[model samples]
Each structure stands twice: as C-alpha cells, then as structure tokens.
Target chain A: MSTADRRRLLGPIDASPLYSDITPKVHSSVGEAGKSDKEVRKVFIKTGLVSNASGSSYIEASNIIVEVSVFGPRPIRGSFTDRASFSVECKFLPYLKQPQEDLFRGDTHANNNGRQGLTEVEHKISQYVETAFLPCIILEKYPKSTIDVFITVISTGNTTAPSSILNLTNWIVNCSSLALIDSGIEIKDIVTSGHIKYLQSEQRLIVDPLENEEREDALDCLVSFESLKNDEIVGLWIDGNQKLLTEELLSKFIKECSSMSEKIRANFNNYLLKLCEN
Target chain B: MQEVDQISFPPEVLSRIAPDLSLERHLKLGLRPCLRSFSEFKPIAVSSPALEDEPNLVGSSIVSHGQTKVICGISIGVVEAKNQSDTLNQNETNSQDSKSDGEYDAEPVYPVVDIARGRTGAPTEEEMILSQRLYEWVLQSKIIPASALLTNPGVAIANQTSSSQGSSADVTILYPEDSDMPDLFSRVKPYKFVLYVHLKVFGRSGPLFDPCHAALIGALKNTRLPRIYVPDSSIYSIKIPIRSRGNFGHRVKETRIFIDENQDLSNPLQLNKDNIGGASNYGLYDLSPGSTSMDVDPNVIILADLEGDAEEAECMSKLNLIYNPNKKSINNISYSGGGMVLTKDTLKQCFKLAKKRAENTQ
Candidate 1:
C-alpha cells in the first residue's frame, strides 16, 4: 500500500482496474451527409449577456453553442507595455466531449493519466483566434494593459469526428469579434471566419460541411478575414488527410472561405444596423 | 481617473463593485445575472458512456449543465479479506455488521474531484467538500449494493495431464462452481472490488455538486465488473541475494492473480437503481418589501441551478435536493440557511420542483 495523502482522501492502494468482456458497440451513421454543400445551419447571435463582464456574446450555430466574454484594458500592476497585450483562452465544458478526443486528447503517451493544462485542441483554437483578431484590434490605443478574450464552448452537438472543430472554431472567432465590438474596444475592423471541406473523391468543395459528412481523405480549411481591409486574411489553418497541396488548390480553398466570410459579414452588418437603430 | 470615477458606473461595473445590489436589480426584472429566471434550471446534457476501451476504466460519463461540465471515470481495485476464515460467514457477518452500524448493505465509492483552474497543488476546499459530500450521499442513498462487489475467482489447468507436464498447450479454465472442479477454491479467501471515481470539472460557472452527482450516477449506471481469477500454479518461493545492500537473501512468495481477458465473462454491476435520483440545487433569496411587485411581506424566491458569481456569493440560503421519481421519495436534502430563515412553504416548494426535475430526468 502507498502512503496516504494527508490533505485528501485517497482510495484503496491495492486496487486494479477491472477488465470488461464485452465488445464495444459500433455507432450508426447520423445521416448528416445528406446536407447540401452550399447550405449552412441557422445561426443565432446575442451580445452583452454576462452582466459582470466588460462585454460578452453568445452564439449558437448548427449544433455548437459558444459564449465569449471580454475582460480587459483594465490596469495591470506589472511592467508596462506601449500597446495592450492580447490573449485568448478557449475552454470547453468538461463534459462536452472534444472532437476526435480519443485520437488526440493527450499530447504525450500518458493516455488516460488525466491531462493537465489546455489540451492541444483548445490551445490551437485559442492561438488561431488570437492570431485572427490581433491585427483587427487597435491594441495601441489601450497602452499598458491586457485585453483578454475567454471563449467557453457550451456544446459540440455530440460530434466525435476531428473535422467538426473547424466549423466550431469559425463560430468561435465570429462570436469573439462580436464580443469585442460590444466591449466598445477600438478596432480597425471586424474579423469574421469561414470553414470549407474539399472532398478528394468527389473533386468538390463543401462550404460549412456538417460533422457527419467528414471523411478521412477530406481536406478541411478554416480562414479568418478582415472584409473591410480588402479581404485581407488574418488567420489560416488547414487539416488534410492525404491530399497533396498545390498553389492553385490552396488559392481555390481560400477563395471559397473568403466568399463564406462575405456572407457572414453581411449578416453581421444587418445585425449591427438593427442594434444602431435600437 | 477623476472624471471617470465621478460619473455613475455602467451596469457591468456596478455588478463587480456591488454584486448584491446588481443581483437585486436583476431579480426585480425576474432574471438573474446569467439571464436565468427564478425556478428555471440550466438544461443538462449527458453524453453516452465514455472510454469504453480504456484498459484502466470500468465506466465513464460526461455531463454538462449550462456552461459547466463534469467528466467522471470509474476504475476498480481488489483487496483480499484480512482473515482467511471470514469467507465462510461473509454474508451473515455483513448483515450483522449493517445492523450494528444502523445502515444498509451498501458501499460508497472513493471519488477525487479535480477542478481545472489553471493551477496545480492540493485539492481546493470546494473540491474536497464536494467529494466528501458525494461520498456521504452515495452511502446514505445505498445506491451501490455491497453484495454486487464480491468477486469469484477461477483457475485454469491443462486438460491433458501429459500436456500439462510437457508443452502445457491445452489449458482449461474452471470456475469455482464448475461441476468438474467443485472444491478448487474451497480454501481460498473471498476478494472484493473497490470502485474509484475520478471527476474532472471544466469551465465551472457555479456550484459543482449537482453536475458532479449527475455524472457519477450516469457512470455507475453503465459500469461492468470484470472477472478476475487466481492462477492454477504452485506458490513457489524465490530467494534473491542483495550483495550491494550487504543483506542476507530474503524469500519472495508468488501469489499473483490475473484478470480474465475474455470479456464474455464480465457482468454488469448491479446498482440500486431506485435510489439513484436527479439532483437539483436551489438558492433562496428574499425579495424584500418594495422590491419587484412585492410591497408588504418579504417574499422568498427559489432559484434553481445557481450560476455566476453574484448569485453564488450573494445568495445566503441554499438547498440541495435529490428526488427519485420511481420510488416517489426524496433521497436527500441539504439546506444551509446562512443567517437567513426558511419557511415551511419554501421547503415544500423546493420539494415540488425537485420532483418535477426528477420526472424530467427519468
């Protein structure tokens, strides 16, 4: 028996994990493949929900539910910087199973040793969101401060595939931008993102593909853009299975994402217009 | 700084500076800071069983209540009885012990709660309290029947006596109850399995007990106990010389057991399903006179599934209830009226709401 933990109650020391005799059940396909390539799920966006935060926004797109809260430009007691330092933290509800968690949950080979810190998935999303909004936010205006964006994934709609993350990240980026606008932060332009999947077998692209339609050979691409700044790309992330990348194919993928971004920008424009009128 | 401080602060700023006042203002509008109304619980989603193929896990579940999520995984361990003679009268002694203890024949699982707050050290007070409470409640409810944890061991032998001495290629496993080996385990002591629950909370936005309990119950409901057996081999002793340590050789006895790799022999762990109930939490806040539409007597409002800092910190009186609809019974109720009085009517209301939640979860 191992020594007891003085501070906490630790269970038995001689216990071993019980083995199972039954085979796992195979899940049936959810039939999301029938969704049209050009169609996107209905999106709902609301701003200023968290009463205590400087600014907040909640978004529900497809099966994913996300909330973003911005707290910052508040004073810091440490060393000062000429421009505000920006950071993004993305966290999923512990029970909201991550996409392809079984394949990629732990960074090392520790497997089920109980991961610490942010999983690779959360870190990548936070990094991308931060990079996407870095240029849009006028960080120089708020000198010697920090602007922090906290993204909380409320649900992933029970998706288990890895490709669903691209679609989810796209929504998170858009929601964060709305939260920034709500915070009344000085920014150069609103940043919006789009996701598309290229199917190798079909030789076609599906914009805003559903989770069920993801295939091992499909190429998933997510791009964030500042539409007002001549559609300049601020962030780009691509996940490919086995397809060889060419310059022409990459540009084609970018073009599809930019068009999707345009559509999202138009919707945001109308929503902002209604807010101004109200 | 002077000019900014002189003007009245924004509503968000006021919430931070004076949460009590801000909460009262929102309650007047029939909404909490998280935009939830009184008596409305955050909807919860329970994912299917998880980590089924994990070698060290018997069962796992993930449950999400609003923005908070709790993942629970149950691993198992085995311990032998200290007294080798106890196996003969284990059942009778267990009942007698229960009678003397004034409790049922149930076992509480060991649970460890790790809430990720971007820091690492000993468990925080909130985690410890939640874990202790869960352990106590599980025992009080008698959800895990102790009898279900008793394990039976089998032994494997070569079918052919000649092959057993030679290549040993024809090994045949025989359980204690097998007709060909009725007396195989007559002198062996009985072993019991122990369940250890690991709960990890992420993005916690409010009180954690309710969600943690849900995840625990879900994982237990699907738990399956594996078959373990003792090896049919000699208990040979080996002596190892330790020249470097300058010590005499010590004898090491071999008494290791093995878990059956064949999953077909595994059995679903039996749980007292009727005692398992949905847990709902309520915060009692007084809508004082002249607040909202109440102008006379102080009205007490019960908010279900408390969320956000303002409610968690400002709500002085709290109640946690677990109701089982199948049994039409209230399994547990924990109330802490922090310097506040709770009327009988408020308790009755909470029970009613608890029953409704139980029925919905069922």
Candidate 2:
C-alpha cells in the first residue's frame, strides 16, 4: 500500500469502546435492608507478607485488596546532609481497568504535567499516601538515608463505579501504615483513613462506600486521621464539582468521615494487638 | 470581530486572576490568609531521633514547623580507601603532579538527599535544589570535621606509613599475609565512610530549605557512629570471586573487611561543642574572646526557620543562618526574595537571634 494510503487507514481516533456494559446490578442495600447505610465493610490486614522487603502488609476489604512494602532507612547516594528522605510509589495491577473518565473530568487540571512515568491515577494516589504518612513518620531520625514505601493494588472492585478510586486510596493509606509499623519504623501514631460520599438527593452521607452505591452526581471526600491524636487530619482529598457543593454540606461530610475514621482506628488497634501476641 | 470572538482566554488565565486579586488584597491589608504576621513564623518543634523505638538507625530527627513536617535519617557505610586512591592517582597525573593528600583530601564526603513527595518518576526540581543547598551548606560550614570521621587511630597511622612507602608498600600493607611480615597486618585497617541523608517533607509548604536545614542539623547532632574493629587475616583470606570481562575469561579475587558488630557505638560527633572555646582554629568567623565588637555593622535579622504565611509572602526578606553557639560564630548565612536592605547592625541582630534560638533548643 502507498505510504499516504497507509497513513490515511490509521485515521484520527474518534471514540473508544466501553470496557464493559454489564454494570453489576446496583444493590439497593449491601447488608441488611436498613443496616446497609450505617455498616462498613469488614477489613482484613496481614503483615510481613513480602520476605525481601524490610516491612510489608496486605489489606483486603470487600472486592479491594492492596499490598504495601517498606524498605530502607538505607543509605542514599546524593548530597543531602541533614535528614533521611521518604518516598511513596503506587501501582495498579494490569488486570484492573482504569476508572471511568467522567469521574475525573472535573479534575483535569489537577494532573501534574511533570509526572511522566506514572498514570494520572497512580500519581494522585501516591501523592495522597506520601502526604498522609509524612506527618506520622519520624523522618529526621535517620540522617543521610531514605525510606521508600511501594504500594500495589492486587485487585480492585468494579472501576466503572465512581467510588473505586476512593476505596483504593483509603486501602493504600491503611496498608502503608501497617507496613511501616511492621518495618519497626518509629511512627507518632497509626493513621486510619475513611472514604465518604454525600448523596445530595437523599441528603445522606455513606461511610466506607461500596462501588455500586457511589452516585456520580454526589460529592466524595477521602480523609486520613492520626488515630491516637484528637482526630487531627493528616491528609484530605476531595472530588466532584465544587460548584455543586455547599459549605454546610462539606462540613457535614467531613464530620461523617471523621466519625467513620474512629471505627477504622479501632479495627487497626485490634489487628496490632493480635500482631503483638504472635 | 471574528478573530476576537475566536480568541477565548485559556482557563488558566481566568483562574490565575482570582487568586492574584485575593492575594493582593491581603497584602495591602498587611494580613496573611492564614492570619499569621509578616515577621511571625510558624511554631517549630525538633525532636532528636524522632522515633524512640527504632534503635537500629544511626541518627534520625523529625522537625515540624507550622503545617510543614520533615523527617531526616542518617546511615553510614564503609568503602575501601584503595578505590579512592586509584582515582586520586589519575586526577594527580592528569593535573601535572599536584600533591596527593590522603584519600579523604582527594575525595570529600558527598551525602545524598532523596525527597519523596508527590508522584513523579524523577526527583522534583524543588528536591534537587533543596538537596544541593543542604549539601553545600554542610560542606561550607564544616559542620562535621572530616578528621572526626577517620576510621580509627591504628588505621590512620597505617595509611600514613603505606602512602609514604609508595604503591608497592601500600599493596603489601593491605595484604600483609602475603608479605614476610604477617604480624604487621595483624591490626585492622581504617576505612572511609559515606554518610547518606534522606529527607521526606510532608505538606507543600513553600521554601523547604529552612525546615530541611533545621531537621538535618538536629539529626547530625544526634548521630553516633559505631566503633568497628577489623577482622583477623583468616577472614580476609577467604576471597569471594568476582566475574570480569577480559580478553581471556577471568575472575578477580578481592579481600573484604569484616566489621565487629559486638563493639559499642563510638561517641556522637559533638559538632556543636567541639570548637566552642578554640573557634579561631577554623577561621570561618573572627569571634575570638575579645573580638565581639564588630568593625562592620552586622545588622540583618536572620530568621533561623521561616514557615506558613511568612514563607508564602515571597516578598518579605528572609535569612537562614546556621549558628554555632559553642563557638559563638555564624557558620553560614543565606537569604532569598527582596526588601529590607540589611545593614551590618541588622546582620548582628540576626546572629544574636539565631544564637539565642540555638541555645534555647540545646
């Protein structure tokens, strides 16, 4: 074929096909009829799973599973005289599909231009993890060194639903904290994160939201708190159109997330106690 | 008319206008959006070895100032001084026979800084700048004297003797068992160490240089290197084979130094107190016993650590000074942005403030 004809054959892409049309039938209630709204999914945590890493943890809840590994307080080869460096890396398994574009449509500007290697979602999640855990870690304790946290999503719930990203981020934060603790790194307090979606239509806030329940039109906020402290928020990430959100609604959502965080903290403490016994 | 209609302003242009107007309004009112004063700094707390439970680390510290938090960790590793001498020989031969002072003089310690913030594949520009500045400040200030890190007294003497006897003697000394005088190799050889500094800053507080500086200083002060003893010749004789690509297939045999882990850690470097009384030896500052009165007006206000609104103001004058209270001298001074031309009297005030803060923290 002629070069021009071959080039013309590869025409400008007009549209891409949807990955799946069979949206898992939305369940009106995930648990018992009235209990679904108040109930959060049970969290399962396991640590020291990765043999080579200095510390590692795996977290599972509902259809989501995340693994995090902590390495170092090892020497780094640059000219940093004062303190140890801390970094976070996040990756999603290839089997998992990317979140629907519509969910992140309003936040196009938020994608940093300089992050060339990471997908937009991976970059966002890693940044969130770094910011949330930064306050809890005693970085200055190791000078001229680096501590790296690597997080991988083994599996995730259906991504077509809007809440998948939020769920993934929350699990990453929790999993990383366990891994850091496992590595015997000195931390100020355990960090527990929770995701909440505000359903404006029903005027209800859903804590630890499931994928099918996340309404695209609703506002969502993911918050992480230092559990031992007085609910001092270490990291917060909000999504959805701000124009659709009111100050009162945002405050109410925050309060709901804060309360939900307490429950998650209790679960973490129980897990730690069990870990110590062994 | 058609062209003008088609020229829609980019969204970024419209977004930038709003924040600029708000910032300008706040600046005019002499108020920061965070409600902090122009001269006021965020609260700062420095904890040495920030994590009490991690006893394995050599040195660690956490510095939280305002909304910004930074953690610093220090790790040390030994590298053979022989490899350094090879490079020194090349450099000297290339430079027309310049004096080859020992390995330490030929290759100065270069600490690495790795900042993990946000999710970019490569190191961010801010990380690079902060790392460079911290490295420069530490070296220029001579915070830790190079001599203080010499492996051990025995190693230092052996190194001096071998260098004086030429390259053949150096080889014989390193592998004394091969020579007739096996007894000479009985003592352990001293080695040089490279210190690695890692810093992780949380929150996107502007101007990280100051917080990182404070955090690093705290970690260095708390650092205690372990006392390592050289193992016996039997251990050295057990050579590990290393593959090498030669015209004929070959394996290179090398001796390895074993560290005695049972030995106790050496005393902390004590950078703050080492040169306090004998400050004239270093010559960086002329703060001798009777030289407090300044011939030059040192009238700058050096803000040791700046954070929050004061950092964001961008226009306010800020100076970062590293003060050595024990020596009663200013080690290093750096500043950024514009306004408030500093007189010598202002510089003196800055030194006084830095000294006071350093003393209070100690």
| Top of the candidates by TM-score | 1
lDDT (0-100) at residue A133 of candidate 1? Answer: 93
Predicted candidate 2 versus true structure: per-residue lDDT over B98-204, tens digit per residue: 22322232222233333433243556566666676666766555545444554531211123354443332232112332345545544544455445566656554
Candidate lDDT values, in order: 0.75, 0.57
Instruction: Tell me the DockQ of each model, to 2 decimals.
Output: 0.14, 0.02
The i-RMS of candidate 1 is: 7.4
Cα lDDT tens digits, model 1, A107-220, are: 222122323467778998999999999999898999998888888776666555677788889999999999999999999999998899988878979898765345766888
List the candidate 1 regions with Cα displacement exceeding 4 Å.
A1-31, A41-75, A91-113, A152-168, A178-186, A211-218, A241-243, A268-278, B1-124, B146-270, B273-362
Looking at candidate 1 chain A, the ten consecutive residues that score lowest on lDDT are A105-114
For model 2 chain B, the run of ten residues with the poorest summed lDDT? B278-287
Off by over 4 Å in 2: A1-278, B1-21, B50-56, B81-109, B153-187, B233-245, B263-265, B270-313, B316-318, B337-356
Worst 10 residues of 2 chain A by lDDT: A7-16
